[model samples]
Target: MDMRLEVVLLPVADVDRAKQFYAQRMGFRLDVDKPVKDDYRVVHLTPPGSGCSIAFGVGVTTAEPGSVQGLQLVVTDIERARDQLIEGGVDVSEIFHDATGLFHHAGEVDRVPGLAAGRASYGSFASFADPDGNGWLLQEITERLPGR
Candidate 1:
């Protein structure tokens, strides 16, 4: 069997705010943002150059709005990634490294599954959220990452 990522569903209480954050702040392209019903809206956004997009709305319930726990979008250069988010007015953290390598930051990060005993990667990254607290990790892997 073979599989590839197609889309992700993010939960947010305020669709408009979530949409704005992704589009205006994160540079995600607004692929869809329209009314599905009264007081309900569906918003979809894709990274600047990505095939996958994240879907969010007011009524969907895969997870509670602002309840998205851990989501990481890996990149090649974390510093540049963090800079872009900062330029967009998003709050970020200082860069740090560990055994695995180096990493930036993301909402309260826990040990990623299968990471070495006490190693972190070097990449300027950080955590930020949507209106409802859907957390995200914008990471940049400077050296060879585990999965790569």
Candidate 2:
């Protein structure tokens, strides 16, 4: 038996706006956009090279918009990823790393300005948010940890 995370449900006040942000600004692949009923619709999107996708639309979730946070996307090059997002017209934060040389802290604790010492893998990060304020973090991982 295997459990894989294939999709994440996002809550947005305006479905079309969220769709445009994720599909056009974020450059995610639009996989599905179907109206299930008069008040229900489904929109699924996947990142460029990711198996997991995100879904949002009418009647998809009851959570408040901008409530989802700490969503992470891994990249091999943090600077390139941040540049790409900025080029796409997204407001991305400057690259930073944890002062403790481990994972980042919640909110903005232990956040140091610029990349980690020696540009270590899994240590560099940049952050951004969608139109609805759903936070996204870009982590640079030149090499994965054991069994990742």
The most accurate candidate by TM-score is 2
Instruction: List where candidate 1 sits over 4 angstroms from the true fold.
Output: 98-125, 142-148
Error of 1 at 49 (Å): 1.9
**TM-scores for candidates 1 onward, in order:** 0.74, 0.97
Best by lDDT: 2
List of clashing residue pairs for candidate 2: none
lDDT of 1 by residue, 5-76 (tens): 878898777777878888898899888877879867788889977778899887766687878755777766
Give per-residue lDDT, candidate 2, residue 66: 93
In model 2, which range of ten residues has the least summed lDDT? 102-111
State the lDDT of candidate 2 residue by residue for 66-127, as single tens digits.
99999999999889989989999999999999989998988778899999899999999899
Please list the residue runs of candidate 2 whose C-alpha ends up more than 4 Å from where it truly belongs after superposition: none
Q: Local error of candidate 2 at 134, Å?
A: 0.6
Please give the CA lDDT of all the candidate structures.
Answer: 0.68, 0.93
